[model samples]
Target: MQQLTIVTPQPERPKRRLPKWLKRPLPSTEMAFTSNVIEDLNLETVCESAKCPNRTECWAQKTATFMILGNVCTRPCGFCSVPKGKTGEILIDEPERVAEAAARLGLKYVVITCVTRDDLPDGGAEHFYECVQAVRAKTGADVEVLTSDFRGNRAAISRVVEARPDVFNHNVESVPRLYSRVRRNAIYQRSLDLLKQVKDEAPDMPTKSGLMLGLGETFDEVLDVAADLRAVGCDMLTMGQYLQPSADQLPVERFVPPEEFDELGEQCRKLGFSMVASGPFVRSSYHAGEMAAEATS
Candidate 1:
């Protein structure tokens, strides 16, 4: 008879255990204080939203990367831990609240990032401008805005440039080849174009971009991406080991050693970047104020 053989599906392999260097100490009381400020003001931070490995360290130091708009992201990138779905009406008071949080935290420099709000008309660029203005007016702090691509809208990008934040950051997140798997809805070239546009409009602005290593990208591929950033006038770069946030996210392909990150940082410096931060715990905003100061100095 034409009976077919039964097929058995193989089980998925277990995730690799984190290396010793990836382990962080438990959150301190200062972290609780930072959490209380965010909670009291109902502010959102990428540190918490993305399940960042450096949340405890950053918060304990009384610094945070504020996430404007809302917590729900519109993109379903494979590696992010931020929740994705439809969001409510934009929080009109968010800018003011973010200002208050920075003031209360006694911050001299603030970094504001947002979820990809594709639902918004300007991709939440106006809100970013408002937050930048609000924080500057409220605390007189140097502001850095890490923004989404705004669907490649030039007008929207211009509006943010007009706000005149101290630093402009947009993370490429991964190399071009990995876009389909790592950044599902994002276009690699589109991101590069956005950075270029920022520099085009505001030539003196210090533009920055970040990359998450350990997602099966080659060492040469990482350097090529750094070169791409430099070609667009990107001034600062941050590279970090990508840790899978959870079981649902993409698994880690490799654990890049600490020395590799150091070497990459050196190479990027040779490519004419003014500032480079690369390490297992390096996020776009980690020690961001210090990096900005050194770059501008």
Candidate 2:
């Protein structure tokens, strides 16, 4: 006689869901107004291009971080969702358009950032200066410029420093160990040099750098990066959880809990960072105006 045998298949595990704290209500009318203003002036923003999780909330508050020098980026960083490709013609009218958008929105403080434009001679430094000047001329609002490293071109960095934006921010994006995988084509030392150069050129100008966590970096590594920034006279720091923009980008290794962020923020403050913003939803330009004001004050 033969014995009968039976086997049952195992069920697949469900995907990890975003925690409750990350959820938000649907867009409001204020968001619609912010979108309309940006569209009317034909301007671009990092919020829309990067698929930032805080876009809905920031727009609903009638605030946005404008992205200049065209939305197409030259670098293909693994963690970013901004479109990357060959450079396009410089939009000569972009500065004025950004000014108009800021004026229409009644923004008291404007934060302007740009995609990496390595193809250009100065990495768009002169354009950044013009945009800052135009915004100041139009709205009389304090302007903050978050710029690329300009490939560590001293002349290019000096140009923007001379423009005298209220704050000069360049994000390190990740710790040194993860730079190769997280920020391709970016050198960790070069970024540090850029921040140092900004401070050296204009000691009074507040310099800022940011990092995204949850990329397999240990807690000590993040603090070490902060120490490096502090060594170079970085005046402000922003830490945030890295979220995958799409399937093609790097997947989230972990969803860092809010309490951990709070601990990191406290640690950074003890390291002497004048202003620190750390949390799941924090972005380089998130609450940028408030950070600038508080840091400078």
Candidate 3:
């Protein structure tokens, strides 16, 4: 096999001029509802914090992913916009609030994720588990939890697996070559290993993962990563065009045309992923529960 490489056209540092399209749409009524629910419960969410471009569409569709625990992260990565610092302290009431927020939103699909809380003994794994359980009891949404690796703690991971969320997501943000450059604080193989453990523990659950493109990642590397996920029995994957969250963040290497994303998604399906959600706007939790449902069926 010929070696494949992603030849990225090195773009200049960062463009200050925002494209008219990138200008955010006015906050819709749904954003208000979602915000109120979050604020009412005193919860934090990636949808609101990271400035995810999908917020208006996802919220308008009545789906919002929740960020559990506090918003402050223990580790900072270049590709992310989540606030990072010394995690002040765990909010004892957070899990219940998340459950309440799910109830208030009437969400049929809920995505729960948290900061990398290495400060705690269980790495906050139990908190994730409880949040899922709470949401299930309150709103009964099909659950998906995108979690940290718990520093590769199998026992801590098992605590989450036992809850049996409908979908388990662990995003390897980029390939190993770019891991250090893009997500320097994150360990590439550990993310792969974490997904493996999720599948190993909950084989019946639809296991899913995602990757961001245009971080100078080669298309072949994307395909190879897809193959790697399939080899381990991951059932679903999401591929999306990477957007530089801010000027300080990594710049986009290539536009990654829509046709190419379509081809990649089809090839990943051929590689044995039960389902693939691929597009410019797709994110880690993009239509997550629907894809997981498809995978199970």
Each model's lDDT comes to: 0.94, 0.91, 0.83
Worst 10 residues of 3 by lDDT: 14-23
lDDT of 1 by residue, 1-297 (tens): 899999999888798999988887777456878999999999889998889988888888899999988999999999999999989788889999999999999999999999999898999999999999999999999999999999898899999999999999999999999999999889988999999999999999999999999999999999999999999999999999998888889999999999999999999999999999999999999999999999999
Q: Estimate each model's TM-score.
A: 0.95, 0.93, 0.90
**Winning model by lDDT:** 1
Please give, for residues 1-297, the per-residue lDDT of candidate 2 as tens digits.
Answer: 999888788864344578887777776556888999999998899999999988888998899999999989999899999999987888999999999999999999999999999999999999999999999999999988999999989999999998899999999999999888899999999999999999998999999999998889999999999999999999999999888888768878888999999999999999998999999888889999888888878
RMSD of 1: 2.2
The TM-score of candidate 1 is: 0.95
TM match of model 2 to true structure: 0.93
Off by over 4 Å in 2: 1-15, 27-29
How high is the lDDT of residue 284 in model 1? 92
Off by over 4 Å in 1: 1-10, 27-29
- Order of quality (TM-score): 1, 2, 3
